[model samples]
Target chain A: MMNPTAAMLVIGDEILSGRTQDTNTHHLAGALTGHGIDLKEVRVVPDDTGAIIAAVQYLSDHYDHVCTSGGIGPTHDDITADAVAAAFGTPIDVRDDARALLMAHYEQAGVEMNEARLRMARIPDGAELIENPISAAPGFTLKNVHVMAGVPMIFQAMVASLLPTLSGGKPLLSRTLRLMQPEGVIAKPLAALAAEFPDLSFGSYPFYSNGTYGTNIVGRGTEASELDAAMARLAALFPMDGT
Target chain B: MMNPTAAMLVIGDEILSGRTQDTNTHHLAGALTGHGIDLKEVRVVPDDTGAIIAAVQYLSDHYDHVCTSGGIGPTHDDITADAVAAAFGTPIDVRDDARALLMAHYEQAGVEMNEARLRMARIPDGAELIENPISAAPGFTLKNVHVMAGVPMIFQAMVASLLPTLSGGKPLLSRTLRLMQPEGVIAKPLAALAAEFPDLSFGSYPFYSNGTYGTNIVGRGTEASELDAAMARLAALFPMDGT
Candidate 1:
């Protein structure tokens, strides 16, 4: 069976400005891979309403699932929630349930539920909240899009909470054969092996270290046996001992 | 004058499979920012021809420049050059200049210039080659799109060679003020500050550490004096000692 495809939309000016390096996409890609989902695409856009809305609409229309991180905070630049609502043509307001959660947490922490904090409670109509254990603010799922926090800790927690709820297909299995030979030497045979096992996908990644060239031939597929067979053929073609 | 806008397209399945963490985007972001070019958007797509063509077309239409990395290798999965040529409706073949460079390099290294190695010589028609000193394979610029290698070392080298050729605008100046207060506390005044300086952009990044919430308010503008005045107002509003 084909795995469900997903896309990640990372929204932040800080990432575009080179002030912050986004790790959420990498983390989400791994988690989704293990959960039998294919992360097909990732996009990073600045905190602009038009850009966010366009990306959301495009990604949502293309992929089975869409995960977004960043710009969900209480700051002025945190405009992701509203932009997402606009993308889906849904009305958003401070939902009572989300507000209650924020109110309870802030009250316990001796923090006032100010307007900016209340912005965190704004949820689109007919959306379910994704629990954020790290922060009191909740992420929401509207249609196929999962809107989450920009903070790494909170984004990770939301992903952890949300993944278990989605149905996953067979996990993608991968095996790698590292060869000291350059990719040019391995490419011809690797291409033949890839053609032989049409069910599997092969990737050759080259690296240079210590003044030598090496390539890592990775075979990926849902079936472990197919992956192993392809990897074995690749290993036979470029024997480590021979190199 | 408005800065020349650019978008990055990272093409590879390894990045999507979570086997490789992409650092090229971050490096390009910093480099473009330093060059006074605005990196407006970034997209990471797998090694698919349709996806690469679609992304390249969209980015080329939207931004002043488009930079792509990955899929320009000797392996079978390396289809970026062909896809990019298809995107612009231009014919691609092994150009004399690129082939000469690769041939010289392989001869010097005592390596045979086989078919797989010759694949690296493919260049789109009417495209200018971006010099790759690290590797003999050349990256090319077709119209607004600049296609480079995936490896970080070569990607950086290509970027260094390409940036000096592009025109840039005024360098974006940034100043930050860290406050020992929650973003909710700072949001209201920060919004007012943003409105007061219509030319400047304000971003508030929140952090939680040592059982306390603090925010880093970053003000960015092309004019250094304007940025400093706005930062001074923000600092006065959120006195550090008072918190």
Candidate 2:
């Protein structure tokens, strides 16, 4: 059986402009991996409605799940919800349940539910709300696509709420072996070991820091024992003390 | 006049797996912005050849320039060069110039240039090499797509070499106002201020730190004095102490 695949769409001009470094994709990747869902692709697009709509439609059709972050705020640039609705060919209006959640939260905090804040209540037809514990404005799931807030905290909260509801496959197990040798020297033996175990995936990541250069060989597989055996062979092939 | 647009394609399973946080995109974003190139989109795909080819082809076609980072190492998983060749309908092989560069560097460092190491010499047809000062493995530019090493330091060096060759437009200027008021409270007046300046783009980023919530309004434009005027209006409309 194949593992569930997911594609992430990050919608923010801040990220593309280099004003904001996105930590949300990394966070989602780790969490989704833990749940055995393969995050196949991630795209960061501008705050444009046409781009959002095209990306949402394409990713939703290709993958089992499509997760999106950003552009769901109470601002002029926050047009993700509307774009998503258009992608699904559905009409959206201020849904009462979502409005009640925002209204109650604001009422409790002694804040007014103004027009901008009320914009959060607009939900597309036939969508389920993903609860937001961090803030009252909820994210929603239209079919397989999950739309959440851009802020890291709110995005995380929505993911936490959304993950348990989806089906997952066996979690991918991984082990890394760090070598003092540069990638060129280590590449030959590593390829041999990789050929020996065709089922497992081996990745070599090179790093140069503080005048020390090395490669981290990562072995990933679904089976723990097989993964361990591969790491053992890798360690023996390029022993730390030998290099 | 519109700025020259660019798209970044980050190729690596490590990024998609959440094992590594991609710092290359952020670095490129800032550098490109400074050079007056608008980084419109960023896509992170796994080390799959077909995916890489598709992305490279699409991005190369859509934008003026497409910058790619990762998968330019001497490993079995390093297939970016081959994928890029296939995308452009060109054959790839070990070119004499690239091989000479790697051979010289390895010989100077007293390292053996094995078959695996020689893999770095493979360049697509009709491509120009992007010099790598950190490592000997040269990144190449085929048409508008600039392929570079995934390692941060090496990626930075290749970008430094490539940026000077590209045509750049006016640098984007920005001014930010940090307000203690929450985004909900400030959205109305902010929209009015945005309407007043059609040329400038306004972005409101909400933050929650140390149990305090506030919004940062960033005004961006090519015109310096126009950006300042918009910011001044924003400050007057929402005085910090008033809220």
Candidate 3:
């Protein structure tokens, strides 16, 4: 069975400007893959409303699921909630449940529930909130789109909270044959093997490490036997195993 | 003057599969920011030809420049050259200059000039070669799009070679004020200050470190004085110097 395809929409100026290295995308990618969700595409756009809305709408329409990270904070730049609301043409207001969650957390910590903090409680009508354990700010799910925090810790937590709710297919299995032979020498047989096993995907990664040049040929598929067969063929063609 | 905008197209299944962490985007983002080029968007697509062609065309038509990473290798999955050629309605063939470069490098190193290796010499019509000092496989530039290898070292080198060939605007200047206050407490005043300075861009990043929570307020603008004024207002509004 084909896994449900998902797309990640990362919105932040800090990432685009190179002020911050985005780890959320990487974290989500790995987690989604492990959970048997196929991540087909990832797009990173700055914290602009039009861009956010466009990306959200496009991804939500195309993919089975859309995960958005960043621009959901108390600051002026945090416009993700509004953009998402606009994308779905949904009315947004401070939902009582989200507000209560924030209020309780803040009260326990003895922090002031300022207007800026309350902004985190704003949710589009009919959207379900995703829990955030690291901070009081809650991510929400509207239709197929999941809006989460940009911070790696919170984004990861939200992902953990959200993945279990979604249906996942069989996880893709991959096998690697690490050979000391250079890609230039191995590319011919690798291409032939790839053509023979059309269903399986093949990737050759060249590495120069410890004064040795080599390639790691990865074969990935849902079927373990097919992957094993492909790996066996790869090993036979390559002959030598350096790794 | 406004900077030339660029969008990155990352072509690989490894990234989408969560098998590899793509550092090339972060590297290119920082490099483009330094070169005064506005990296407006980044899209990661799989190794599929149709997807690659679509992304390349979209990014090339939308942005002033397009930088594509990955799939330019000797293996069968390395179809970036063909996909890019199709995107531009151009024919691709093994060009003499590119073949000569690879041949010379191989001959110097006593490696065979195999058929798979020769595939790296394929260049799209009306394209210029971008030198890769790390490896003999050269990347090419078609129209405004610069296609490069996926390996971080080689990608960085190709970007370094390509940036100097393009025109650059004034680099954006940024100033940061670090305060030990929650973003919830700072968002309202920061938003007001952001409105007061329409030309500058402000970003607030919350961090929890050493059992303390704080926010880093960054102000960015092309004009140094405007940024300085915005920083001044931010500092006064926050009234903390915990940088």
Candidate 4:
């Protein structure tokens, strides 16, 4: 993981309509962590072109890389590709690279590429296709933005393929411990533990009840030993003995 | 829901590092959905004040409401409070209302409020504190922006408490089916399904061969009868033949 920074923009009104649960953002975040690239921001807007363009432009300019999920489908809501091009003030054309991929994909399945399906071929000028092994409609990389399918499986595959090629920092490590005691009871001691492990990032993710929801005190960092030391201190403060 | 829109800004570098698994974004999404308000966007940024302020300003202006998670801790990385003030272009100050909440909670827990602890009481001018039931330090609302604790439990509690007073749309309805078929095999039918149910949003998700992943063909709408009708039409497309 190289400390490279990135941002994710989720595009679709379905997400805002509460009709779609965004599986793409969570999956990307988890994958990016392994690469050691920091996901600095995530923004989801309706399939509105202006929102998508503004977010893509903002993130691309600010972060080392910017990844977008959703809105690149056959449907009308699939406006991500066009929006991304507009964001960079680039012209969108039916590039040979994307059309070949979409066509080959269609031919393999014994299908004719019609108007709706051709929408996948509209690539922004100077963009390269990110291989969609699972699905034939290839996602592409333009400037620093990587556009992938909205569906979680396709999205994850595209991200997995893209991550290894991207330079990143060291892999971050973590240690999680169950803390039954309330946060207020342990806040003082936990703060000391966090202070003691300045080299390691110790975040206290307190849960509510376990059978329903319980508090989990998690410690994390780039160093394993540092995480262990922090967790040890946290464990001592909130012991499992009384539970 | 009434199309009441909200966006989430998750402020943390720890998440991008893969050092921390962010639970706040998902938690807030679910909570807001339950309350019938759509969580349109979730942005995770580093502790950088400028980046935080930019995201806050963008989200607050575009959506009907904005909710931010993380970066509210006492540590130096906790720049959320400062960024919130910056987003509103207001001078930061430790208001009496916030100080009262933290003091009462600290007093009840028999802990002294030190300088670092008192920093939690700082709020932007003319903001209302969103009560934190789990921890004493309260979250606050500035205009339509609701700044809450990064911790999932506390963040959730803040939403649960604050949502009743806010306006929300009628909750959207959805129906999902696990399709064992490949995306390509069902592409035509799926496209037809989408066209048939023009008012309802339909999507085809793809999965892999490990007997693990399954594409959830989901349909969504405000009308239950319309959703049920779409589902029935979808079911008819699949032959009754089973493995």
Candidate 5:
């Protein structure tokens, strides 16, 4: 069976401005790969309403799932929720359950539920809230788009919460064979091997270290036996010493 | 004056499969920001010809400049050059200049000029080559799109070689005021400050460290004096200790 394809949308000016490095996409990619879903594309856009809405609309229409990170905070620049709501033409307001969660958490911490903090409770119409255990603010799933926090810890918690509920196909399996030769030395055989096993995808990553060049050939597919057989063929083509 | 808008397209399945963490985007973002070009969008797509062509077309049409990294190598999965040629309907072949450079470099290194290695010399029609000082393989610029290698060192070298040739606007200036208070505490004043200075862009980034929350208020604009004035107002509102 084919795995469900997904795309990632990272929203923040900090990432685009180079003030912050985005690790959330890498984290999400790894998580989705393990969950038997194919992550097809990732787009990082600034905190603009029109860009967010356009990206959300395109991704939601094209992919099975869309996971977005960033621009979900109490600050004035936090415009992701509103933009997402506009994308679907859904009205958003402070929901009772989301408000209650925030109120209880803030009250327990002896903090006031000001208007700024209350903005976190705004949920779009007909969207289910994705629980955020780290903070009281809840991420919501409006259609196929899953809007989560930009913070790594909170985003991770939300992803953990959401992935378990979604149905996924068989996990993609991979095997890697490291060769000390340059990519040019293995390119032809690798291409032949790829054609021989049309079910698997072959990727060659070149690395330079210790004043020597090497390539790591990774073969990926859903079938374990097929991947192993391909790896075996790869090993025969480029035999490593003492193996 | 408005800065030239640029978009980055990262091509590789290794990044999507979570086998590799892409650092080239961060490097390019910082470089572009320093060169006074605004990086408006970033997209990461796998090694698929259709996806690469689609992203290239979209970014080329929307932004003033497009920078692409990855998928240019001697291996089978390296199809970026051909795809980019196909995108603009230009014919691609191993040009004499590119092939001569490769031949000289490989001869010096005592490596044979095999067909796989010869693939590196394929340059599209009507393209200027971007020098790769680290590696012999040259990156080419076709129209508004600048295509470079995936390897970090080569990507950085190519970027350094390419940036000086492009015209840029005034550098974007920024000032940051760190407040120990949470973003909720300063959201109101920050919003007011943003409204007061319509020319500047205000960004509030929240951080959690040592069981305490703080927000970093960053004000950005091309005018240094205006940014400084806005920052002064911000500092007056959220006074930090010992300052």
Candidate 6:
């Protein structure tokens, strides 16, 4: 079988509106890669249920694992818990395991746990809680999808909780050839070299400047040896001085 | 009717692999906002045609416009142009307009336009070119979507060309109040205020610090008056040093 693939669905209208710069998706992408899971796709949608359900269904079925971040807060806008339940066609009620943890957390912190605060206790059926060390309210893993918080610290902590449980594939490996040559000059030769290594993925990201010159050609693959060999070949073709 | 909404599909495995930070989406989101157009979603998919087609279909039907960046380069892995054609179910033969432009570009640059280069000239049917001022081979606008170069400079320029032609809504008005209060602290009251003005969209982005304290509460709305009133209320409640 092919390597295990993962996709992250970041749900929050705040991100698209430019009201918030999403850091959780970036964090999860890097964190998952370290655990040897190949992150294939990432999508950011609004808080709307229709968008959330569609993304959840698509990502879950297509990839080996799926992760969702945001919308797990206490306010009315924090509707991911309910939406996730609906996406799976499961009923969402207060989850006892989550409620106990949250209650204890609020009690120890001397904060009043209201009905809205209790909203964080709601979880979909047949899911296990992904512990949140930073905060008491936990993220959950349902089927292959792990749903986490949007807050950076909480999200990172929750992701950390889930990372240990994941059985990953050959970790993605890459090498960057920071060449002083323009993409146009090296495009044909690089394309020929890329065809030789179908297992590896080669990308040329061009950076143009009047004073300084060059583009960063990045080669990526699940195998370390392939990436190392490609880097060696890349160096031979395009030297530092653009020869 | 509401202003036309656009979604950006960023095609690259580099982004999901966490080797490269995707900056194009942020640039597009900001530019779309300035044009008074709503950016509905942003998805980063791998260079897989199936993934690209699925994302394209979902966003195309749901949003008025869909823009894509990356994967249109000379490399074999650069399959965005072809995948986009497949997505629309259009037979993507080389069009005269793009070929003429690309041929002129290659002649001026004194380079042989190879088969890989020609792939860029093959856009989806009925697509008009979005001007790329930095580079000659232009990005195309298929229906509402404008596909542009992955490189930041060319992407920005392409967006600039198309922004003028887009019918804009009342410029999205935004005012932010940053305080050192935890989001949960202000969540209840602020949510109530936001609900009172249902037209406005309120976002709370929380930040933590070893020495510093507070979250930045941003309020945005389509109407200037509503924004002003909300801003005034926020200022009054939070004050300059309320936190």
**Cα deviation of B118 in candidate 3 (Å)?**
0.7
Question: Model 2: per-residue lDDT, tens digit, B163-234?
Answer: 999999988877888888888988888888889899988999998867778889888889998899888877
A36 in model 5: Cα distance from truth in Å? 0.6
Model 3 agreement with the true structure over B1-243: per-residue lDDT tens digits: 788899999999999888898889899988888888999999999999999999998899999999999998888899999999999899999999999999899888888898889899999988999999878789999999999999999999999898999998878778889999889888988899989998889999999989988999989888998888778877886565556
Please provide, for model 3 over A1-243, each residue's C-alpha lDDT reduced to its tens digit, 9 standing for 90 to 100. 689999999999898888998888888888888888999999999989999999999899999999999998988899999999999999998999999999999999999898888889999999999999988789999999999999888898999999999999988888888899899888988888889988899999999988878999989888899899889977986565746
TM-score of chain B of each: 0.96, 0.96, 0.98, 0.92, 0.98, 0.93
Task: Give the TM-score of chain A, superposed on the true chain A, for all candidates in the order listed.
Answer: 0.97, 0.97, 0.97, 0.92, 0.98, 0.94
| Model 3, position B76: C-alpha lDDT score | 89
lDDT of each: 0.92, 0.91, 0.91, 0.74, 0.92, 0.81
Winner on DockQ (4 vs 5): 5
RMSD (Cα, Å) of candidate 1?
A: 1.4
Fnat for each predicted structure, in order = 0.78, 0.77, 0.80, 0.28, 0.81, 0.54
* Tens-digit lDDT track of model 5 for B151-218: 99999999999999999987777778888888889999989999999999999888897798888888
Clashes in model 3: which pairs? none
lDDT of 3 at B21: 89
Q: Identify the superior model by DockQ, candidate 2 or candidate 4.
A: 2
What ranking emerges by lDDT with the best candidate at the front?
1, 5, 2, 3, 6, 4
Query: Each model's interface RMSD (Å)?
Result: 0.8, 0.8, 0.8, 4.4, 0.6, 2.1
| Segments in model 4 whose C-alpha atoms lie over 4 Å from true places | A1-4, A12-38, A71-77, A86-122, A151-153, A167-243, B89-92, B177-181, B185-199, B208-215, B233-243
Worst 10 residues of 4 chain A by lDDT: A206-215
Q: Is the docking of candidate 2 incorrect, acceptable, medium or high quality?
A: high
Q: What are the per-model DockQ values?
A: 0.84, 0.84, 0.85, 0.27, 0.88, 0.55
- List clashing residue pairs in candidate 5: none
**What is the RMSD, in Å, between candidate 3 and the native fold over all Cα?**
1.0
